[model samples]
Target: RQFGEGGAELFHSHRAGGIVLPTGTVRVEKLSASFTELPGFEDGAWWVQDAAASLPARLFGDIKGLRVADLCAAPGGKTAQLILGGANVTAVDISKNRLARLSQNLERLGLSAEIVQADLLKYEPEQLFDAVLLDAPCSSTGTVRRHPDVPWTKTAADIEKLADLQRRLLARAVTLVKPGGRIVFSNCSLDPLEGEALYRAFLAGTADIVDDPLRPGEIAGIDPFLTPQGTLRTTPADLELGSPERSGLDGFFAARFRRAG
Candidate 1:
């Protein structure tokens, strides 16, 4: 049942025997049907952005005329969000193939950005930005509900490797932001090692805590789930247990940081 060429067939064959429901239908079909009905997919007003993933664009407060960089910007969902929020965005990603997809999205939305295909770990822009967002790549555990096949594909060692890469990307992003500018570090991951732990390690030596505005009543009974300083964590259960409309959100974690002046 696997459709793609890259190890997908093996993954699908293995998964086919692992889970079974009363209806005897494939879970993938059910998931696809649910996704197609989501608001973002129909009118194309917005893409499927995790509720928590939207927080980073707001962290900068005012970006109307500011220079912003979205590193690791492939598949450009965040890039589009930033532009809609009024930042003059420069979207960077290492893959030309992925950037092609990003370009298509921008064209579809009638939005534009300086899309650069370069390895952010080594690429440098001619000018610095007022703010930057490093939505670093990581072991995507937070997406488990939407991507049930992830846990079967990834391993603990993969997380460790990604953590190291994230650290490097954060350091580079910090270097690119002006003093007093902001950077929001985020990952679609529930692993504290990749989310909170990565932020803590970065803040320990550079940057400082900054307030993150939460939607009123967003954290009703989950104070412990809130970071000590009020970062946000969107969980699968939070979505699944809510009304059908709310159940469409993907799991995510996000934190905002400010460069020390």
Candidate 2:
């Protein structure tokens, strides 16, 4: 409750598990606290989410009352982000089961979205949205710390397979947004083939879309992680130089695209 009483690199979990930072996060100082123990846990002050995983949703500066689509959204973190910004979101996920969890989470947080169970590859909306957030499925190499078995279970071939799925999903996302609307494509994979390379290919084929590059200070402390092409790229290797153990952010890549009419 009193986050800033003393500042010691404590972070607040904005439910990618953590956000707000230093003063706020799921934990208090070096101590790991249970979800039930954290302030507002029962009241839905926030959900558990990795700090890095939460960044992509902030790409949209403000969108009060706008229609947005959160594709592949389940156990909805980004969906919550969009809702907090006052977007009327259609949260779509192929897994009806996961969407159930999403619904429960939002209900606890006292937020709501038009939940839909549909596959990103084939689900067709009756109309386009003003914005689309495609946190596309990938090999998830970026989240190895949270799920340690990821690296061991995944291979280059696995990345190729997931990359293909990402490609198809992003292609469908492009179709789902209103002309001149924006799309933020993100994946929790450090692989360029799945993140950066996918964007490059999409650019080549689509004449009506242009890169909506991220700028400096857009998201605090993210300057070093940005690519020359204006995408945020992170890795497990990007931990703070001195404190290798404690200070770290997840490996993630995100790029915004605008459909140019």
Candidate 3:
């Protein structure tokens, strides 16, 4: 209502809960400040987040009473979503500065979580969680449109390096969640070797974890993104679909796996 009238031509990511985006919107590409300065933001109704970026947190369905971990969580947009979705979240990140932003975001949203500052590989919890979200560090090629610096900053060697790091983080994330628990692993990279291929290898080597395919209508407008294995491979351009407005999303891949109990 307000968003539409504001000349932002936004789309509702879902009727239930999500940040409404101006149709064809990209992250941080400023819309009119009217929406931002409105009472909704000032009143802590919602925080800024990319629509595609929000999907990984939603992969763990109905985690109301479940304990979850946002491993490598900094600038905690997904952490807030988990908290709102009824999961008790332990947000972990390596950087103090990034954690500080996450803390401030949570506070503004009137949400709360247990915050841990430590490296994902080195950090160990006394008990594992029921679910975990790992939005790993990547080459950022998928985010080139929103983050123009990504193309200039990342290299092929960097992609390989990040892929290796992603594997390490996924391995650690698996250990942090209980058997039968799910790990939603996501990376903002378009490379198959980095995302799809790497996860396929992880599945081959690890017998206990199995791929959990996403179903149609589970997440609105998700059909085109599904790969044969049921993982999600999202591109920035998908949302536009010939829309007259400028639209796109960061390249991102997400997969869900549940450990064998």
Candidate 4:
């Protein structure tokens, strides 16, 4: 249902945040507003997640009943998305504590998934999945707008170390998918070294894998952020839809690939 006149006025006057995504995701652009205090949250009508962070899982068109592995999937945001899309998800993370939080979230959302605690490097499944999502660990430079201290907390060397780790985790994710299966690799770092450069290096070496670029109009408001090679790259400076205080998305990069049959 469309908003009534009064509702529309309120929504516009408050300058809410991002456009409503197809998935019904409503981004909270007002940084000072306590989103949790709003209605619908208590009923699990929504969950907290940066709009940019919510894009990678959506690269999978229709995952109904598809088996998906979510590597390094703690806090369960993407995992929850996949489950909502009707995918059978195995959410894996190394931190037991984080997995516990994920469990709580899933329960609150009335969603379910097979949760596992394991280091991605050593994780093994009895069956290969139709797809895998690797939201690898990174320097998290993309979120500096929300956490200004991020730039001072890490170094180039730290980024290099994290990039290497992401490369390995991505490689592992590829192995877990069956032939012709898809993989969406992503990280929350603005540096190309941890994103574009790293994926390119891996693609150059992996002959069995091929890029599966996003189709035009696949994601609403996504055209401005797409790379020429069809990857999604968003920075805090992108997505200028609101006031200067709430105009950009978090820095994130993501690419999709398919294994040769």
Candidate 5:
């Protein structure tokens, strides 16, 4: 709607499926056709991303004109969100192929960002950013609804390894942001080891970081997903839409932190 795509009516008129999200995202409950086959998709009115995938970027809130580093930002959904939110973004990804896809998406949306292909562990920037969004890679157990093969393909060992990798990426993310800047760490793993446990351990070791919890009423339809720790955790069993099949979002977990100045 922000891009003048005409909201749900646009999809309805085209006989497509869509439902509005609190974050202004149009969730297509049932796609009548492929994303490219959907009307206005080629025109870049919107991009394809799960509603849960959109949360981590929103955690920064009102990032207009802020310099933000989007680490591991391939496929560019969150990066596009940052650009549309008026942030100057540098999208860094390790995969060249993925970065190419990200570039194409940005071009289609008529948005631009500094796209860098480099490992987060080895990449160095001239200056720190005002904010950082680390959507770390995980076991992807959260997306089993769409990709049901996730559990079969990924083992518990994979989750453990990914959790360790996320911790390293998160630490690196903190270093890329300036003091007093905020960071939103997120992953699609439902495992606590990759979500709450990892974040808590990081906090225990890092003294200069403080929790920046997501408060109720900040985001519509999000109260049910807020945790006692102030983090956002959405499971496959959450978000009662209407029917069984239409309910719930991807099992995603997100937590925000502010580096002490």
Candidate 6:
């Protein structure tokens, strides 16, 4: 029954019956329908972002006037959050199409950011930032609920390729932060290879990296699977049927790292 390259079509149609968040009371059905039919789905009243994904921006502490760079900021979910938090944000991504979407989202939210379309590996900013958010692309295993197609479309080889890219992106993002600034590296994948594994590797290669902790009670009703070593993860199963509060969130993994003085 698997269809499409890597059986993506088959995987997309198969919904896991069990709810990952057994105690969650959020209504799963209404959330899904709202996302698709919401008036601003395309116009950007709200962007598809996980509750965990919002943690990295908070780790920055305070950014009222600080210069911040959001590397790989296509479709600008994190970028929008940063701007809303009061940082002067600069968003960069390699894909022109996605950048257009990011721009639109910023516009809809009544926020503004300097949008650059360029590969972070080769692009250079005019100055270092107070903080940087590198939400790198990965195997996306942590996002199976929203993107079940990922398991079918991606392979071990694909994960390896993404890991390589993540390393490069991390290296470049490090260079963009000031000596005392912070960098948050995150992905929507559960593979330790993408989440904790890559983070450990980055710390091993660089001496300035330090773990940044999440604020108290930032994640109150989220699924337990989403929390690990201060990182937050969300899955589709976390949404509760019949309840309308915790539904409609995509799975995500996030970690915050600071550049040491």
Candidate whose lDDT is highest: 5
Q: For model 2, where is the 10-residue window of minimal lDDT?
A: 1-10
What lDDT does each candidate get?
0.68, 0.78, 0.78, 0.82, 0.85, 0.69
TM-scores for all candidates: the values are 0.75, 0.86, 0.86, 0.89, 0.93, 0.76
Native-referenced Cα lDDT, model 6: 0.69
Q: Could you give the C-alpha RMSD of every candidate to the true structure, in order shown? A: 9.7, 4.4, 4.8, 4.1, 2.1, 8.9
Pairs that collide in candidate 6 are 26-243, 27-243, 27-244, 142-189, 142-190, 226-233
Decide which is better by TM-score, 3 or 4.
Answer: 4
Q: Which tens-of-lDDT digit does each residue in 197-250 have in candidate 2? A: 888998888887888898987766667778888888877766445654345667
lDDT of 4 by residue, 85-165 (tens): 889999999999999999998886678999999988998899999999999999999999889999899998999999989
Candidate that beats the other on TM-score, 3 or 5, i.e. the better one: 5
lDDT of 6 by residue, 140-212 (tens): 7766766667788888888888888888889889889998788888777767777677777777788877777
lDDT of 2: 0.78
- lDDT comparing candidate 1 with the true structure: 0.68
Q: Write the per-residue lDDT of candidate 1 for residues 106-204, one digit (tens) a residue.
A: 775567999998999788899988999988998888788779998778788888899889888888888888877888888888788887787767677
**Which clashing pairs does model 3 show?**
9-23, 10-22, 24-247, 236-249
Off by over 4 Å in 5: 1-9, 12-14
Better of 1 and 3 by TM-score: 3
Decoy 4 TM-score against native = 0.89
Q: Pick the candidate with the highest TM-score.
A: 5
57 Cα displacement, candidate 3 (Å)? 0.9
RMSD of 2: 4.4
